[model samples]
Target chain A: MKTRDLGSAAALAILGLLAAGLAGCAPGFDHLEIKIDTLPPLAVSVDPTNVELPVGIAVGITATPFDTSGDKMDSDVVLNLVPKNQKVLAVETSLDDRSFVLFGVGPGTTSISVQVDHESRTDIPATVKLQPME
Target chain B: MIRKLLLLLPAAGLLVLTGCPVTDASTGELSNGRFAYLCVDSSDPTCDGIVGKAVIPDLLAVGGAFDLEYAGDSGAGLVQVQPASDVMISSTAGTFAFRIPGIAAMLAKNNGGVVADFVHLRGVDVDHLDVLGESLAESIKTLEMTTGVAAALAVSPRDRLDARLGGALAYTWASSDPSIVAVNMASARNSVILAGIAAGTATVEVSLRSGLKMAVLVTVKQGVPMTTSSSSGAGGSSSSGSGSGSGSGTTTTGAGGAGGGK
Candidate 1:
């Protein structure tokens, strides 16, 4: 009786070790990683950088983005323009062209912010003063 | 027997998981920093009709199949009037007709005046035409004749205008010597002219002597528009995006293949 009991205990231990090995081999999940990089910091650059324009002239805002992994992230970018603490200028993305256009801008100090992945980036504040149309 | 079976099953599962072949994700090739003029409208007589007079670099990809049309044009209708020759049209203004073969042919016939003569060259000095002074009207006329009634004159490298003319104008660059000026116009007439010029293998140089002498060089070759876009990876599959904007608004989501093979 004692020998039979010892034999049964040994068999159970061997089976338990096999089951543990199988569990270890089962597929295990790994954490996913996502990253992003900006090509040029969000900023407003006048096409001429500096220009004399008549009042009520329309100016365009161009923004570009870059990624470290060499991945194109154009679709994930956004642009917004706030004028004189009133009226928000929202821009639409042209991912195919990797560009956005902000049209019909009147001269004044406007706050421009670029957002990517929900993160907002504002350019160094600059005055956009337009010359009064003669 | 059961113990051996369990061990074997674990080993088999491990083999299945670890032995899968890895795949390298497709990556975008850096644009050769080149552009092409594509007439995407098939209905425009110039769809694949003629090769415009613009000499696009050889490293670029040029096609008109994906070009967009004006507000009231149908995508299918534009494709119907496909051109048998080359054509050129303005990048700005008016709906681009894609289906008229006659339109394409016309563009190919007139491409030299519209596309090649109109491109702006950086680092080269151009005589600035003051649109507000006494010379404004004459300057506007010269610009209109050079570009077209619908074309506007813009500062090179930057599209900002010193003045907005009522019509079109071709823009071009002067070669190393101020002796050769090349203009590019974005229009169907120019595209057709370019195709005709390119087919004849002719090299035409026109010099306009005014307050300042400027030379225009006309060369025709294949052209393609340069385009770039973003990507999103999910579960080992990747997708392309359009008009995501730039900078902080961009997002990269999901799992993807290993980078650089680690």
Candidate 2:
């Protein structure tokens, strides 16, 4: 009789655990809801694609990136200023890492290409004209 | 019966263990996402990075290894997370955690989504990595050029005409009205001699590879120019073993060219 009582109690525990396990196995149970964003940017862009600066003056630059959906992606982009005339134009990046300072060293034009990761890049044509800072 | 119960006990424990599936707990969700980054500055010397913002920074120093943390509905604060180099589990306070390495490469390998907005660096202040509008497009200034003799086409700073390709001292010149006055680029290194074939107004232009250009109106009178002068500057035609004494008059009208509007 004692064995019978012990067996029934053990069975109850097992049933209870199995019921809980079944519930846990159900969909939407305690599962790690992970959605790793894995989309490559199709286009790279910059804010104010065109910029101008006077001699001895400076401007900030912003590079933007977009994915295949044409959505502005949240990613790191590289900015490169290819000034046709470096004597007339120069660029420096800020610590903020988001903006760059364009100095009108002299007078001329440049091409700013922002690379969106290793996959894509876009060019923004920038022109700098000298206005003698009197 | 006892044996049967004993047999079920192990399975019971296993079920109980499995029951703790990481679903919506009474508190919040446990899953989250991550990313990595690298950056450079526009400063001098080593413009790679700055702990913050600065005018003068170590040149060519590119700082990197930034990341992101996006949590699901469970707003409960992160509890315990393995703060290691190889991996990161979301259910912890791993946001901006530095000890983590290879996250950037891992994400890159995954071809994960990238964010251009902001980042949190361990040794550096959290800041926006990419920004715009520091300097704006004020007014476009056109490249300046002067009118030339109708029958003669040549480059001359003395004529108040400048044409530099990529800001180099060389360029290719063309005439809008070639019949009135034609330009031959092959004849000269920096100068485009205008051969006045007839009397008419023509547009003489100088340009560079960056799409930068300058144009001016040239009203060719009856006669070809007696002498053609070369510009005297670093990239000047005159300075390049060439001579410039005079053009009819000072340059007039610095008009628009290819890259002016841009």
Candidate 3:
């Protein structure tokens, strides 16, 4: 009887341990997720496409900014004249508007590019002819 | 039971630990937005480095655009002028002719000398002919021929011209339209030069003749000082456990008892 009791007690203890282990495993899985929204597309278009101005004269240029979502982006748009050596001659900013006018450029043919937050968004090569005062 | 409890303790602790959310170091609220700082060292003769520092601002507002022109010791080359409208000039040996109507012929005549030699008009207004000259024609002609609508002509003093010409022949253009406004070349230069040098404390004047009416000043300084600094943090938690048990007693005693009974 004593031996049977000891065996039963040992079995009970083992059962209890198994029950505890099973209880620990009962909780359902938890999932946490993080996601970022897509950024809006930015587009730029220049009017007149080409410009010619005599040296010492100021040429006014207009740059238009557009976003894919039709929602106006508050980002500032900058117009820069990039020379062959990649040196930036002039940088002008337009705020919350579709167009900007840049004045007083020196003589030279260079690429005009637009940057949004320092990111090159669009580039168009342009020729500038500066005629000496006759 | 106690052993089972002990086995479960680690699992329970783990559940508690896992229940807490992990904090991402990179996900903290930003204290500020970014900024670009440029410091040019013009004071130190040996140090010509331009230090650019990017800093995060305390809060993100709509960013602004900036255009900064630095005028240094490198002088801008020459004076330039731009005409507001088209101008036409006809030059004859001793006389200058302008296409503008109603101007007298006397206003067109100048002692056969280069226009550059007389009347060094830097930034004269085309509308102002009285001070510039009588011949609106001459003004128009100069404007048409020059990149700038304005021309700078230096008129030698009569005494000087008399001495220089030695009375061989001398002529001057007179304008019938005395009401025309003329821009003061000297004043214009002063204004432009001041505008160019406004950025630096050092009074180095740089003048460059960029175009007709375009003058640029490039300024270089010896030294400018600059400084910068940055910091960041992250954290996580986990727990786990397992347990097992078995028991048996007295097989030898039972075998001996069975032998005795047999």
Candidate 4:
């Protein structure tokens, strides 16, 4: 009976160690926020603002993510973009999904929702205007 | 006449043969060293009118094709690029195209000897051009230039990250109307000389062999006295870019006074 009690205690300790090892593998991010790195000319009033694109022209958008701790995360973060109005704007995602090329399809207003590691930011405004003939 | 001529020819031959070394004309042999030359074929549209020479000054973009012409006395010679991955010579017959982005030296050789002309190959993986006097979107609406003056336009080849690529020969400068503005390659890699010929508007385009290109609209006005302060101001404006972006078109500062928004 004493041996059985000792064996049970040893098994419990082993399980606790296994649980602690798995806990150490968790991701460090408390939360993720969208960060815009580049913007087109005359498209935004300032940095970190809405986009205004010229029709038939494209604007490159580079979106990196920062965690709640304000530390910029690298490749591990998953990024996804969904445009509310595909007729006005179309999003072309890069191989890593962190970078995007937003093309103005027509003259209209739309919005893009960016999701990073399951945390999403919605309603990023985009306006497309007609380009004057040269 | 024939008999006399024949007798004279034998006497002349005997006198020459007395000290001259004998050589077999029938046998395919070269007394001197072998030689070869390379030229660009008309297959490359960018170099279509350009006659192939020992060295090509133009830069070729990856996936751009250029025909290679080999002329040599060496029977069945071989043509290959050093660092073979930079270009693909699908046929030794006489054509080649770039496969990757890098510099490679093309060599043509065989049992006789290597060709005298060695082609210096340059390739780039370019997506867009950062024209020094263009907008943030990399487009120039209108550029005004003074007649009888030169505008230094700097253009850079950028990859996806907007990082600049090297090798000046990889870019080609062309003027739509040379009468208005003539395109001249500057000594510096990124800068090009747009010399105003007359009062008119022309398009100056820079391109890679791969067909990736950018253009600037240039309007030449009547010449002024060209004051030192104006010249300095133009140079300063080109250096200080009017557009947005870190170090974008910075090389084009000399173009500022030569061209401004009109």
Candidate 5:
């Protein structure tokens, strides 16, 4: 009778552990949140594909990166913008790093290129000129 | 049953350990980025022994150029500049130019993101000028040179104590009288060679693109200068001795000699 009692106890412990193991295997909401960040986006684009401004003035612009399913990525990703002719126009970074400021330095024309994580996103044609006399 | 429980306990611990995968995003060609400046010209003495001295970014001037090296595991990719318009990088590896006067960060990026970065402050005005092979006192406002000899003069940008490339290409040198002294660009853009054309006085002026100017008076002599000495009085001395043993004649002779000397 003692041996039989030990066998029943062992069987109960095994069942309880298996049930716990199955519970742990079920995916949690937190796992889904992690998946959202780890997924890579497909393409990045900048608003206002072309820009024109007067010298000595600055304007802010935004960049949007989307995924394969045409969904916009809201995660904090590294972005860079470079001007082809710095003497004509310059790109400055704001506090949030999500957006940029373009300053007109001289009366000329150049193109600005956007980069996301070592990949070329898009090129923006920018023109800077003197304001017309009032 | 006890043995089975022990085996199950080990398996449970193993499962917990393998549940989460460790992900290090900086693995492979994305780790340990470093930067350095390689000296391409010998005229800039600051480049001497600068191979490993570039642990920190140094000051630069507008229109100045430098050779920079971005060291890292690029993983089959090339490094490029990002985000600043005050500086420019060239297709040739490690060549950079300062375009404007401002504090800028030259970010070096590759396929793995920003692997290295260098921050530098650029200035437009020069603080001091140095005449090679001459003392600071001699080169401050006036410089003396021999006819047919050339003196190399270099300009230092304000607040840049050690940088030798002080926007050398942006400096314009002119002589008040080219007949007295001629100014020409030295091998290093930041320096100029003043050749004494004739024995006369002339002003050598250096101007920056931003409109700041500095001038030095240069007096060219025909040959080496002669240092003259002041005239000194002639030195004279006299001594006289007389025998004490009844030498009346000798005593009289000594007195006469003393009177003559006086």
Candidate 6:
């Protein structure tokens, strides 16, 4: 009977130890509150924000988008050219072409603006002059 | 009526305990019903803390699409933060510690605080709500500019400086040789136009409000670029970024840029 009693006590002690070990194994750092890290508002860069052409000239415009965290975002950048006077300045008129060729269509000064995002934009003013036949 | 009332009470209690409209208490703004969130305990917070977020409309766990594992000791050991994976595990008690890279990572703007860009899903387990894979480190670290841009870019005499940064940076743009190259604007968050105004070598200085500065060389020519396309140096060092000029436009190699990144 004494041996039986001792065996039961040993079993209970082992169970208690197991319980304690399990409790200590609970995940740490689960209670302290932490907030999410954010990425800064994206910045759009239009290289050569302005351009000058003397008719029959084409220039390449590259728009780079910068994130404060430095994540590359070239895939998200959009470029559009809106010529104040289509006759004075002519672009490929595609959303992807950052380059525009100046055609002395009428020899007038017109402004070309490129839309970056939904609301942010930049412009380039072009003055076209009629060149004499070479 | 008592039996019916009892059934509804438990369900209602569960709902209240895990309800919608989770807030970031630190910012005191709604977390837009995110499944995970950071409970900013104090009014003032800094780069020391922050977590990630998810796009869930409520804080409840999903049925079975999760694959969260412990950061270490996979077998029944205490789970610390595993910064590598986007998922973070936390308990109902919510005492968790995660690592943020530095101050700059925390200051990035997003869902309106310092904890919105780390995680994408909630991985709750072991009776603990995997709070948002919440946030960054406790110091301001320097940024290294990497690929996509260069210290020196080459283009046609009339071309513009169109370049992308390897990382995000806010800078004030200025042209040392405006006649050769001029800024598209006085200041831009990330854009600089080194207009090849003339056939010359010029410098474009990009400075941050914190006084971090970088100088890029701009060379414009009508024919093959006059400058060599050798790399200047890596981030944290100022070297003339090299550009290989071809007939039409310019292409940047692995050399120079003004932001820290891969």
Residue-level lDDT of model 5, residues B124-174, one tens digit each, is 324444443343223367788874468877654453353444322356778
Please provide, for model 2 over B48-164, each residue's C-alpha lDDT reduced to its tens digit, 9 standing for 90 to 100: 222222221111111222223322232323422221112211212222222221111111111122211111111211121111111211211221222343132233211112111
In model 6, the fraction of reference contacts reproduced equals 0.00
Candidate 3 DockQ score? 0.01
Prediction 3 TM-score vs. true? 0.22
**Chain B TM-score against the true chain B, candidate 6:** 0.26
lDDT at residue A99 of model 6 (Cα atoms): 29
Q: Over the stretch A20-69, how does candidate 6's per-residue lDDT look in tens digits? A: 99967643221111111222222211233444443322232334444334
- Preferred candidate (DockQ higher): 4 or 5: 5
Better of 3 and 6 by TM-score: 3
- The clash numbers for all candidates, in the given order, read 120, 47, 58, 6, 0, 42
Q: After superposition, which runs of candidate 4 have C-alpha atoms over 4 Å from their true positions? A: A1-49, A118-121, A132-134, B1-262
Candidates, ranked, lDDT: 4, 5, 2, 6, 1, 3
lDDT of 6 by residue, B1-262 (tens): 9999998999999999989554422221112111233322210011011223322212212111211122111121332211221112222232332111111001111222111112222111112111111022211112222222322221100001211111112346676755334455412233333334334465666554445455555565423323444443231112122332231122222111221111
What is the alpha-carbon lDDT for the whole of candidate 1?
0.26
Judge candidate 2 against the unseen true structure and give its global Cα lDDT, from 0 to 1.
0.34
Candidate 4 lDDT, tens digit per residue, A29-106? 443343443333324321234767665344444566665556776686676666788777766553225655565656
Screening candidate 4 with a backbone cut-off below 3 angstroms (N, C-alpha, C), the clashing residue pairs are B40-B52, B59-B169, B59-B170, B234-B257, B238-B253, B239-B253
What TM-score would every model get versus the actual structure?
0.21, 0.22, 0.22, 0.29, 0.43, 0.20
Residue B175 lDDT in candidate 5: 83
Off by over 4 Å in 5: A1-134, B1-31, B39-45, B48-57, B73-77, B81-95, B112-139, B160-168, B224-262
Residue range B53-139, candidate 4, lDDT tens digits:
323434554554444433333334453322222222223334455555544434333443322222344555667876775222343
What digit string (tens of lDDT, one per residue) describes model 3 on residues B159-261? 1112210001111222211111122322222111111101112121212121112111123121111122111000000000011111001212322332333
- Give candidate 1's error at residue B240 in angstroms: 88
TM-score of 6: 0.20
* lDDT tens digits by residue: candidate 3, A1-134: 99999999999999999999996664322211111111111111224344333322222233434455344344343333333322212322222133222321344556655554455655555443333321
Task: Give residue B180's error in model 5 in angstroms.
Answer: 1.4
Better of 1 and 4 by TM-score: 4
